[model samples]
Target: MPNEYPSLFSPAKIGNLTLPNTLAVAPMTRVTATQEGVPTETMRRYYERFSRGGFGLVITEGSFIDEKFSQTYAYQPGLANVEQATGWSPIVDAIHAYGARAVAQIQHAGALSQGNRYRDGTIAPSAVQPRGEQMNFYRGEGPYPTPRQMSDEEIIDVINSFGRAAALAIKNGGFDGVEIHGANGYLLDQFLTDYTNLRHDRWGGNVEGRLSVSVEVAKSVRCAVGEQTPVGIRISQGKVNDFMHRWSETEAGAELIFGTLAQAGVDYIHVTEFEAWKPAFGEEGHSLVSLARKYAPGVAIIANGNLHDPVRALEMLGDGADVIALGRGALSNPDWPHRVSGDMALSTFDRDLLAPIADIKAAEVV
Candidate 1:
């Protein structure tokens, strides 16, 4: 049969790692891990099915980087400890058996953490109250708590944790690479966003100061993963906690941010928005992925958010995006790539199905 989406099925490379297709499963939170942040058989099977269904790359759900305060929810996986990294080996092996590359999304919760079990208080760039209430989807309730201001030393420690976690993920967990979670209003996002970061120190004064941590984290992770392994950084204007936020109001600002990451030596930049095709700033046609490519022509771009339709996905790829990452669309239809290729009907994703993530059976994956 003729392929419906040729761009999607075409091979794409991240550093030296070549993906079988441009379709990738975006990182999604499924709190089905062990209490100690270890990946379970269920988690392994969950990701394995995505690989079998034909995704070329499987970016695992955000795994907290450190035991100190990075954990955001109960049952969330971690890459900080040896045992936790070992837990991911079987899952990576399962994905690899189907010829898919697995990448760990390493993150820190910062102020949006509703389940920071390690430390009593949450940390942020500045002691500001987080936006929005805890999402009910992740067993979170009530208003977000105000975060504690991070000291310079603590900031350095967080940056180092990202490097250590990436090293552990590749060395012990068998992951192809690591994607630093610099988006979605997490610890890294907290620093990048102006409204949240009000500190006067080196880590929080201006745009460059705000972006310093994320760029440094990428550099550190790149060093940790070595030159062969791909190290990508995820960036977004809006965040999970603050959906209406925009990091840069202008295209020039966008260039500066993306250029910084490219200069930092990241193999790829994952640009995410509510809709990847929509214009990011001045007009309705210039999308975030377009701007990212304009700024970082040397880096691969993965476009995420509301790109479920084959035509739209194709358009993004036509616009210079190397990959299309599926989130909810991939969840409902694990065989999304297969369906798109064969031109089959796609199952509609229902948010209700994720209420109790553990109960998500394979039978429902179709």
Candidate 2:
């Protein structure tokens, strides 16, 4: 039989890097690293499984970018230092051995941090307390602490850290590309969110001002990785703490956000939503993936969120998504691409795979 999802198995390009297929593995936080932020052997096998299963691109979970004020959870892997970056070399090699490209998603926890080994407290755009309580899965209890506002010098440091980490991922870790974790209510997303960021300076206030840090980070990563390396930024309106949140500016907000990143020379924009096919703003609005394509026509778009279904996954291509990234779906069926293409039955995702703690389980490796 002809492939049911032809678009998903087609070749695609993100910057200079060419993927074997448009199917990608979405970044999912798996706090299974050593306490010192080194990637473990288990992590290597875990990532390699996806590539070995025929994924064209494998994006690792959000690795902490810096030693200070960046790590969000205990045992979370990092690209912050040489040792951590070096530790990832094997995993990258493993992915490459299976003909899949590896991309590191570097992030900063900011005010939403539940645990941090480098520092005692958290820092954010403003001194506001983040909404919602700590995630028990990541190992935290009670509500989130109010973070101190960062100074001008510190803001520059945060931007520089991203560049440094991207460089480490490329030079030390051998990653094909690096993704800036500006989404999911992290530090960059904190600045983008209005309530989370209440500053009058150039880093806050209006949409452009609020997104200034993201734009600069994208520029910094692009500069650090050079013109040839593929550099992308993940964008999402919702947060791990505030899932139902929406951009106040809606489509107009998307125009500025996506347009600015494209102008900053980002090769791709990864947009995620609870449901990939649903409208971004309201019943009549376009999906966030379509908006990203509309605003940043020059860059590739990776659409995440509930796109595991073959029908929905194929529909996303028409919606302007250059790639379909799977989270829970991949966890359930690492060989989803091969299965879909061969007309094989797909497996159902089990919450047990991530229950108790979100760490990588032994069963997942084999």
Candidate 3:
């Protein structure tokens, strides 16, 4: 079917990859992978359908970057080893064969992990306990125990891990690009949020100090992957601890974060929200997408939220979003890219088929 929204179908360049449209399947965890964190046949088939359906790009669910703070779920996929990368190669190859681009979301759990039992270490911006029930990711009872704060040397080590992970994803996994997990108060976002970070060192305190670590990590990863790979960063005002939480203290503060990222040589900036179209700041009348576009004028901006309709996604494109990334919309309808272009409503998410990937995402999360 011809697109009523031609702008969405118009080809756009995201770094070296030229995607077919603004529609993209956002990264989402699916337990379809093996318990050891390798891609399973189910994972391959699940992703293949998205590329088959019509998404210009498909970002695999968050894969752990390091063995220590990397994985938050027992069922989550990993990019740490060659075997896992080899397992994912076919998935990437399949996406390309079907005419879609593939990207990987690299992540570390930090303190949000509650139920995940790890064989090694964990770290956070501050050791302050997250406010919540002691879920399975971290193990134990009551709210999560306070995490151990990282030393200066430890922070650099993790940044190096991110760089190494990026290199591995490109060299072994065959990913066309990568997105750093900088949102939702994970390790990077945890540092950005003052409520979570109480450090007086160069890595914390004011916005610049707090944001320094993420910028350094971005620069290193960009260098690791070289200039051609599309390196994108995701930022959000909302988080697991408090959905209503804002990463920056104010709208202007949000601008500082976005603008800093823009100056750091990131190829793209992904702004996330619970609602895609709602004003990111009720007082400023700027949605996360708009604010991002405003600050990072030169970088390609992808907006993600509750965009369950193609028409709504098209509206976002018209309003300045370079791309529209579907979250649950993609999860429920593996064929979302195709169906949405034809003006189909989002598929109903299955409660039963969810335990595979959607379940236990982030260890303590849903």
Which candidate has the top score in lDDT? 2
Q: Each candidate's lDDT (Cα)?
A: 0.89, 0.94, 0.79
Instruction: List where candidate 3 sits over 4 angstroms from the true fold.
Output: 115-121, 134-142, 343-345, 350-366
lDDT digits (tens) for residues 1-366 of candidate 2: 237667788899999999999999999988999999999999999999999888999999999999899999998999999999999999999999989999999999999888799899999999999999999888988999999999999999999999999999999999999999999999999999999999999999999999999999999898898999999999999999999999999889999999999998999999999998899998877999999999998999999999899899999999999989999999999988888888899999999888789999999888
Off by over 4 Å in 2: none
The 10-residue segment with the lowest total lDDT in model 1: 357-366
- Give me candidate 3's TM-score against the actual structure: 0.92
lDDT by residue (tens digit), candidate 3, 52-74:
88888898888877766667667
User: How does model 1 score by TM-score?
Assistant: 0.97
Q: Rank candidates, TM-score, best first.
A: 2, 1, 3
> Clashing residue pairs, candidate 2?
none
lDDT: the better of candidates 1 and 3: 1
Residue 21 local lDDT, model 1:
91
lDDT tens per residue, model 1, 36-103: 99999888888888999899999999999998989999889999899999999999999999999999
